[model samples]
Target: MRRMPTRAKVEMAAYGASAAALAVVPSMEVLPAHAAAAAISGGSLWWLYRKAKTGDFARTIRSAQRLLGPVTGGVVYAAAAAAPGRPWWEIAVALGWGGVMAAWLPVTRSTWTPPAETGGPGYPPGFTGLVMRLWDDAEVAPGTWLEDIEQTVSPEHPDFTADVVALAGKPVPRLSDVDIAAAFGVPTACVTLADKPGHGPGRLRLTVAPTRRRGGGIEEVWAEVVARPGGAIPGSKIVHVKTFPAQGDLPARGMVLAEVEPGEVARINHEQLCSAFGVKAEELRLVAQSRGREALVTLYESAPLKGARRATRELLTLDAYGRYTIGTAHDGTDAKVHMQSAAGTFHGFLVGVTGSGKTVALALMCAAWALAGLANWVTSARPDAQMTAVGRHVDRQGAGAIFTWWMLKAAIALMDIRGRINGEVGHDFSGHSPYPGLVLVLDEFNSLVGDEALGDEIAQMTDVLAREGRKFGIGIVFAGQSLNLSKLGGEASLRDQVQGGIGVVLRIASASGGIAARQATGGLAGDVDIAEIPDRFNASMSLMDRMHGTVDDVPGETTQGVGHTVTGSEAVMMRTLYVHLPKDGSPDGLGEIFPEGGGINTLTEREIQELTELGLWHDWTMPPPSAGGDSGDAMPAFTGVEAGGGIGTLAPPPVAVKAKKATVKEQVLAVVDREMTAKEIRGLVDAAAGTVRNALSDLVTDGKLRQVDHGVYAPVHAPADV
Candidate 1:
């Protein structure tokens, strides 16, 4: 140690003298005065000590050492001034004066060490020692250093943040290069990294909110419970503790996600998981593993879906993003379905086993679409389908008419759109009114598509519409137990095309069905085992529980619409909006959805004309009144005299056909009794160019009239237009 300077020696002497005086002053006073002085001095010191412990003051060893002189002098003055009945303000003033002097005392300005000055291989002061050690071991950017560290104090589960700086010739450490929880000594799922907004680059915020372990052995207990006859794999550990929401004043429920060492996942069963988590077997759910390396251990306090959520009409309306809320997600968040996205309109596939709420979900979606101004045609295998609530809003229903209706409507729409695009009359179609969006609902799709007579053709037509219809504002919805390739005509790619919009997998009845759904959805439904969903929601009655009379009289609420909705790569658990449940004597759910007199979507007169002119229209489908006949084979009545040269000329009709009505084609030919150009004939007949041209071509093909000139047609018997 170096010799002390004279000035330092003098300061040390003054501090000693003041402390010694403070000790003697109390004893030197009279008994009553001494007692009063002692009380005043002791109370002040006690308050300071409490505040210091709570971190309200900078009270380190070094700081206390430096502050000793001022503290002793304040106590002495306060004690000496304390008469038996002295005013409280006198003691307050003395304490305040002492605090001012302490602040003015020469001491180191910093309470914590700066990172740069904390040289050598030692960890920075105030940092968690474990974090520094792991950071070094991980080699997270060798030449990078941490600084400006911030930590949450006294938090139930704490978070830490630091600014990263690079040394000469080294890059800053990035968050992706290191697993935050591994390096930070917390659960992987407990670690979250976010950018510190407005802090510029190289600033990372890490939140490590591990669920506070109970009995200080949440993991240790879990490990002991899961231990095998031999032992757990060396590296296996619980890597995640799921955080739960507060129920009333307590936590809702809890779970843990653990990484079972490779090859050990299969060895563990639901019993082990339940025992490990301290939950009953029925209350435990083994969520699907990831790459066979992890096991999700869940403990449910109640059914995930408590009860049926009615699909109110307001819930069917679209938001600005063209999305609508269908139900609540498993995490108690809103589950939304997008009608339109950046990619395009999404087609839907609703698949589930019987009693899985598939029909109710379909009804909900259809009603929503109708309210959103989309045209709907719903077909069901059952004649008494439970869709009466929305029955009025749909254009058609019934398996017999589905294929024909879809083909005609789709063909007409496609033709009209193509003509407009090719003719440059309009750009690509965007969904709205008049030509509102179109959806073909195939309810009980398996029964309808499995019919031997219609199956192959229906499959082929479905493929066509799936490929081409979306661009023209037409979408198809297939609802059934499975949308697997075999059910969809064994066309491997058809499911992908049709389900590009939304996929709902409700409670599946069998293991194979789950496998088929996994293949059909391409695992977009997350890795969920659909067969287990109903069991998770339904109340359980084990043999022992039943023998002991512990089972509820009424079992679980039906897990009807409880299923998964494919959002992206992950499938989210959700309950479909309950549109309606048919009753014996009550009215349909339609009154609960649509307004009293809300009409269904239909084509306008102009749209009708456009369809007819394309020759895509079928007689069995809607026909214009001008066609004047219901017969599919009705021909244009000829009003002409037969010419000798195989050319028939049409003058005006001498008499209208009284037996049957003439078609639009006959009216067009009648307008061309004399020589007339195609445009002139179109103007007189009040028809589109395409329609007039089609009529003229048919008449010419039928040998009713011959072209007299380049742009004009003449009656074959007329004398050269003289």
Candidate 2:
């Protein structure tokens, strides 16, 4: 026969010696014969049980053999202590026999020692060995271990299953560093750290599956995949699982849902979660919720409108409530602006630096208003550059635009009061036939408000229109580069009125501009950080790659018309649709929108008569082109009252008369509401520091200004509206 194994030999030796001790040790009588035999047997059996419980046995040891492990020596040594008659050599031999059996019988081997209550979960077929290996490798807890682990399968996803491990120490963060995907033979996306209710913070759960379980498709849904009605948002799931799609342009589209107390959600760090998930910090977003126990976390993808979106007539068409689609939001939904709600009308402000798509955004509004049967009058400081397309939709004007705007407001006010008095209408404009809504578009509006000679008059008129024109179906849309109230005629009330209606802040030119934009619309738009918005979608991406020395940078598409739109209490980052994209050979989208004599809205005789009575009426005609044919071509004009102080002109046919430029001293006085240095005044006004200082000195001597501190002067009188 083949040689017996070493373990078998050791077992034979241990059993033979123990059997001899039980049979012969009692006869030798360190104690009474019967008592000696019983003591030996009981002591030997206890040793065997201890070995088995601690995972020391070879697993092939029979209970009969295991019980005879020569522990008779230990029993006799104790009996000798009481007897005091036993030989020392005999006791020594008995003790040596007990030692040999203890060392030899429980073959030194490491067997799987699962927890006491629930041994362990049953791993998937062919995965038991790997799970055991990972358990030893992970060292989840040295002292406190997993208990009551159960194999669970998701009801919705047949291929998705997990081992719900119940443990005392939290293993969520540690498990993130572990190669869980390798242990379970699944794609990394399918492995998620999750929580279960009633488990307490001490325990964590994880879900995993085999790659084959997903049928070899990369975009497989995991056990945590939530079935939303339209995939618009990840609804709450009070289970321990992270929902992530396996494939996307980005690394992964994942959502983490946690059931937390009302205030605890604020403490959850999204950036830390992003780090754990191996995504950039900006990718994660904590969705705002009202009172709730669940906190939803998700990632924002790149904006969808990466290229020029052609303007279509259908998109320009306004709804019955005077809302029209301007572009797409970051969430891939349509972005709209409310020109007039059913309850009341609204004014709007659009702000961005040059080349930031300020004009493109304005063009969208103009086209929409034209389609909605509103009379839109377009005017601009830099009129010839980007105002051409918008001009094609309505009558264009320059210096006389403000005068015309005030006259139109008066006409609408007359019409509104007349209708209300006659019981022909309610308090609000009806947005119908003869008294159609009107929009006074003021492009580069900052230039008008910043003009020292006429800024106050324009601001006062604008404030009046903003306050009273809404009830009469009249609105104003101001477009500019900044939202500085001081630059906007220093009227905080005007800023408040424009913001109450609609506000769009595109890529800001300066940090201060961004702060002003964000602060101004904070109530309406929530917490959109316009200052952090990139100039282009790919701008940061390219910069980052170059900084890391891996980029051969290519030109990227602009974030033109990309900004936040605030209406009522909601705001969304959006990209405005292109109204005039020259690269696409559709330079003039307004032509397609109008398709007629500029779609101009002429004044009704009734309204024109009201203007005549107010001394604001001029002949509605275009004057003959001048001999030089360069500058004196009369633009379309309507009868309007002429205001004073270079604000308007007296003409049979209302002609464009340029506004007066302020002198250095007047400019200096206009800006010095607070203490400012000569250098600061020179920076604001296009004048030398010496000239600014001289003007400041003259004003201080005249009592119109005062020196508050060294090199600092403030206005002596409160700034008044001209």
Which candidate has the highest lDDT of all?
1
Question: Which regions of candidate 2 fall more than 4 Å away from where they truly are?
Answer: 1-182, 185-195, 198-204, 207-252, 255-303, 320-322, 341-343, 399-427, 432-434, 486-497, 510-516, 519-531, 541-551, 581-587, 595-598, 612-722
> What number of clashing residue pairs does each candidate have, in the order they appear?
1, 4
lDDT, candidates in the order shown: 0.57, 0.54
Tens digit of lDDT per residue, candidate 1, span 349-375?
Answer: 777787888777777787778788777
What are the clashing pairs of model 1?
389-590
Lowest lDDT sum, 10 consecutive residues, model 2, at 282-291
**Model 1: lDDT to the true structure:** 0.57
Candidate 1 lDDT at 99 equals 51
Query: What is the lDDT for 112 in model 2?
Result: 29
